[model samples]
Each structure stands twice: as structure tokens, then as C-alpha cells.
Target: MAYKSLLTLASSAEGVAAAVDAAARVALASDAHLDALALGVDRSQIGYSYVGSGAVILQIAMERAEEEARLNGKALKDALAAQGPDLRFSLDSAVAQLGALTDLVSSRARYADLVVLPKPYGKGSGPEAEAVIEAAMFEGQAPVLVVPERGFAAGAAPRRVVLAWNQSREALVAARRALPFLKAAEQVVITIVDPPAHGPERSDPGGMLCQLLVRHGVKAEVAVLARTLPRISDVLARQCQDLDADLLVMGAYGHSRFREAILGGATRNMLESAQVPLFLAH
Candidate 1:
């Protein structure tokens, strides 16, 4: 299956360019329609008690934020127009109520084939961005394409890709959802790190997953590495670099979110450490 419809959310002017570039690239690659929603914070939903003069300042700040959001939306439209001459794309703005931003984004993403989002930057690592990611991966029930904060290319989809396989339900789902990308990629390496000794479905390491992908017209090779590092994410990152992979496809949040939050897991570590594009699903 191919990605026919894609969705993305832009939260700030600073990240609008990158977000549009990444989204447009994917849309162009898949010959899909892109729908980008620019986000603005609604001050009325804020819980701060406004004092006499403080209320005026807060109102002004919120107005500025709203205006910035509008400008960012326009920039997105212009960028999409320029980058996607043969691609279908649209841009609009959405005011995110304080507590309902995640819900709004999640509900909107449910209608999309894939969701593209910008990775967190220095000061951009706020609740809003985190919520958008959480909403897309868990609540949206769609594959999430995360672009890095810096140096995002708007021209082409990744040619070389690495698939981190673990024989888990989430990993299988992620691989299947990423079939389009895998089939299009020039090279696909199914990297399995420290596979379990035995699982319910027993077979040669990575062979079963590889055969499933082959049936989909994706020719992939399996690379099994012994678990020698402290964090599997680090190994995956190194493998991506060694293979010169432009994209990494893997499962997200295989374990409970709360558990990953407290103890850390491959999904969390990769989300934070990966510099290349990531195609992730729950």
C-alpha cells in the first residue's frame, strides 16, 4: 500500500520551513496530498490568574502568537506551492485550546495515511510538540514520520533505509506500514539486534520478516548483531551511519509509555538520538 494522504502540524514560525519541507518531500514522493495545520495557542484556555496590568500583557502576547501562527501558515502554503508544482497540498491554521491540543491533532490525524512532524529542537521541546508526537503515534493510530530539526531536504524521499526488527508485534506492524518506503528504497537492511533466543513464532533470525517483505516486492537483507552495547538505540544509530541510511524504520513504544518514561526503551532513545528521518508506529 502507498501513502495517499499525509498530514502535518506546524506550531511555530521557527519550525515552519522545516516542517513544510519534510511534509512536501513525502507528499511528492508518494504522489499524495498534503494537509498542514498551523497551530496557535488559545490564551482563553490558560489557567493563569490575570492581574490588572498582567491581563493586558498576556492578551498582547497571545495576539502576537496568533499572528505568528497565521504568518507561519502562509509560509507553509507558499513553500508547498514552490516545492510541489505537481503535488497536491493545502495549508490552514488551527487554534489549539490549552488542554485539547493533543485531542485535536489526534482526531485530525486519524483521517490521514501518514503523519509528518518536526522533531524537537533546543527551545522547541515543549509540551505542545511532545503532545503532538504522542497523539500521532498512540492516539492517531497511523504511522508517524518524524523529521529532524536541522538540515531537512525537501527534494526526495530517502533512498537508503534501515529497518530495526525485533520480531515483536509493534515491529511487525511498523514494518508492514512502511512497505511503501521499503519498496521504493534503493537499499533496505533489516537490522536485528540481540534477537530473543526463542519466541512464540520460532524461525531463523530475521528470515521470516525478510520473507514477508519479499512478498511485498521489497528485497531486504538481514543483518544480525550481537547485543554488545549498553543501548540498542546507539547500535542502530551507528548502523545507520555505517550504511549511510537516510531513513530508519522501527516500532515505537513497544512497552508501556509510562514504563518507557521511567526506565527508557529503544523507542524513546531512538526518538531522542536519531538524526535522520524516522518512520515509527506503535
Candidate 2:
């Protein structure tokens, strides 16, 4: 399916502009609409808690949250307006009461073809910032494109892409989700590490995946990292750095709710820390 709308969640004007440029690249390539969403904190419902000492602290926090959100919104609006009428922009704020940040983002994801998140602010120790990132990762249904904290300059498009393939449904879905970007990329590399010893032997899954990409006319290559001294995540990160890859696409490995005992090894590792922006599908 073609990606027609790209949504970017921004907290700062610079971030908003960067997101717009990133989304616009894809939109320009595929003739899609670039939607820039400015995320702000909601303060209306912040003081609803009834616990001791909680009420007073909550009230003070609510005022501070509201002020920050308003400030961020104004900054973002001004920045986008300065860019003139070429970009489409929207302002949105969410009140973090009873841990509803995830629900708020998930609701927004339903309308977006893709979602972009800026890395957390401050020392990255803020609870709200952490919640926002987690919500985007686990609850947001659409493919989320993350921009680093330092941010990106305008027209900084992804040239090289790394696909973390593991021959799972999530991985396949992630690849498909990234088809638009992949088609526009200068280079695409499919990397897989620590293949299970018992999977199909005669039919090499990695080979088949590469063949499929070639069939689609994508400039693609395949590399299988021998599980050596380094851990799988480290291996993938090192390979990505070596390839100078700007983006990483991979399946989000996880188990079904019913099968608590079953889990994906690679997925767990990638979640701990990823060196590049990962396009993950579950």
C-alpha cells in the first residue's frame, strides 16, 4: 500500500521544521500529505487525584505543564508560519492525568499513515518524556520515525537504509511498511544475525528475501552476521555504522498474550538500545 500521509509529532519549532522536512521528502516522492503535529502537555485534568499531598503537588504541576505546553505550541506555530504556506501544520496538546499519554497518542495514530517522534528532552530522565516515547513505540499503530535529540537539518533525507530481517511476520510487515522509503533510498541492506539452528535448512530465508527485493527493483544486498563475540544487537549496530546506514527497518519481535513463555530474542535486544532510527512492525 502507498503511504499517503505522514504525521510528525514535534515539541520544538526546530524539531517541527525538521519533522516537516523529513515527512515532506516522503510526501514529495510519493505525493503524500505531510502532517506536522505539535505535541503539548495538557493541564486541565492534572489535579484530579485525591490522594494526600498529591493534590497540592498535582495542582502546581498542572500549572507548570500548561505553561510549557502553551509555550511550545506558540514556538512551533511561529516556526511553521515562518516557513510560509508550503507546509500543513496542526497543534495538539494532551493532559497527562492517570497515565493517559499512550491512549492519546494511540488515538492520533489511527488517523496517520506514519508517525514521527523526537527524542526525549532534558537529561532524558523526565517521567513524562519517557512515557511519551514508550507510548509512541508500543501503542502507536503506524510506523514511527524517530529524530535524534540534537535534531536534523532541512532536506536531510535518509540515503542508506538497514533492514533487520528475522523472517517473522513483524519483520515482513516492517519491510512492506518501509517500501515507499526503500524505493526512494540509494541503498538498502538486509541484515540478519544468529539464525536459529532448526529453521528451514535448504531454503535460506535471507537469500529469498534479497531475491524478493531484487524482483521489486530495489538496490539491495544481504549480509548474515556470524554470532561471534559481540551480542546480536551490537552486531547489528556495528554493521549499521559500518554501512553508514541512516535508517533501520526491522520486525518488533514479541510473543502473543496467550503464549507468555514464548518471546523473540532479537526483539528484546533491539528494544534495550538501538543506534539508529528503527522502522518496526509487530
Candidate 3:
């Protein structure tokens, strides 16, 4: 199904316009409406451990956080207004005050068709931000399009799309969810990595995926990449770059949380070091 509403979460006013522009582009292409959610983070609540951790301290912290949220909200609203009158914008703030990062995202995932989240800034491990992304993938039920923090302009329609296929349930779901963008793309590539030793019959799901896309009226090509490299994320990133792909479509492959940490192999690697816009669905 085509996306009807796009919900993008913004933390700062810096990339707010770009985020809205990207959302508006998608809305225009899919005939959808763009809804923007600007998140205000209370830095004081950064290490807040419990609800009853000194009421006076908590109240002061929450107040500062709310003020920061308001400033961010006003900046975003003003930016959108400057862009033009055609774009529809909605402003709201949430107290990410309680629970883990995942809990916050899960709570917000209920309201939108899709979520657009910005990559965390700086070079340190973005475990918290990554948690937010993971929560959206597992709990949101809808697709999450992650925007890179630097380089590349936002709101540009993807001209080339790549599907990272492993023939898993999550991968198949991601493929199906990417149909709208895939159909509109000028070129589509289905990349399979480290296939089983047997063959296409019992080995290659990517071949089957390519066939499926053809049936769906997508002009797609299948290619296999050797996984000799240490990380699959590196391999996939290189493949996308070599193919000159603007967007990458991949299944959000991961086992249940208790079984493993930070999703699974591919999901973890890609989320941590994603180079292009990725459309992930579980």
C-alpha cells in the first residue's frame, strides 16, 4: 500500500527544513500528507534513574527540558513557515523523561504511517539513538526511513534503489513495504550476499526475490557479493556505492531481544554504519 502520512521526528531546527522537505516530497509522490514531530530532549533527565529521585530536582529538570523543547518547536515551526505555505506541519514535544529509549519510541510509533529519524551527531557510539531506531523497527509495525546526519541532501526522490535480500521473513516484509518507492525508481538492484553453497533452488533467495519483483513490474537485476569481508555492513555499503544507489531497502533481521543484543548481525551493522537512506521493516 502507498504511504498516506509521513511522520518525521526532529530534534533540532537545523535539519528541520530538510526533514520536512523530504517528507513533503514523499507525500507529493505518494499523494500523502506530511506530519512532523519535533522531539525535545531534557538534558537534565539524562541520568535520571527513578520517578521518586528527589521531587524538587526532578521538577526543575523537567521544567528546563520543557523549555528546550519549546524553543526547538518554535524554531522548527518558523523554518517550515519560511519554506512556504503548501507544506503542512504539526509541532509537538514529548518527555523522554521515563523508561528506556526503546520505550519512548514504542509509545510514539502508534501515531504515524512511517517514521523518519535523524542519525545521532558526533563519533561516539549512538547506543541510545540506535535503541530508538531498533524500537521503531520492532515495535512500530511501520517502516522507518533513517536520515543520515551529514552529507547528501534530503528530500531528493531516490533514483536508484537497492534491496538487501537474505530471504528471511523480515527481508520479504521490507521488500513488500518498499514497493511504492521501488516502482517509482529508475533502477532497482537486488543484492544477495554469502548464498548457501547449494544453488538457487535451495540456496539463493535473492534470485527468487528478483523474480518476484519482475512479476510486480519492477525492472530488477540480481547480483551476489562475497562475504569474505569482516562486516556485512561494509560490504553492503560498498555495493550500494559501486551501484550508485541512493536508497537501500533491507529487511530488519533480528531475533528477539533476550536471545541477542542490538538486533542481529546485519541489522546491527547497518544501523550503526548506514551510509545511505535505508528503508527497514520487520
What are the Cα lDDT values of the candidates?
A: 0.79, 0.64, 0.70
Q: Which sections of candidate 3 miss by over 4 Å?
A: 12-17, 42-53, 100-104, 121-128, 150-156, 198-205, 256-264
**Candidate 1, 10-79: lDDT as tens digits:** 7765555666787777777777899988888654533465556667766776786688578768767776
For each candidate in turn, the TM-score is 0.88, 0.78, 0.84
**Candidate ranking (lDDT, best to worst):** 1, 3, 2
CA error at residue 31 for candidate 1, angstroms: 2.5
- Model 3 Cα RMSD, Å? 3.4
Give per-residue CA lDDT, model 3, range 34-126, as digits (tens).
666555554454355666666777678778657756766776676557656665556676656534546667767756677776654335323
Clashes of 3: 0
Highest TM-score against the true fold, candidate: 1
Model 2 CA RMSD to the hidden true structure, in angstroms: 4.4
- What are the root-mean-square deviations of the candidates from the true structure over C-alphas? 2.8, 4.4, 3.4
Clashing pairs in 1: none
Could you tell me which 10 consecutive residues in candidate 3 have the lowest summed lDDT? 120-129
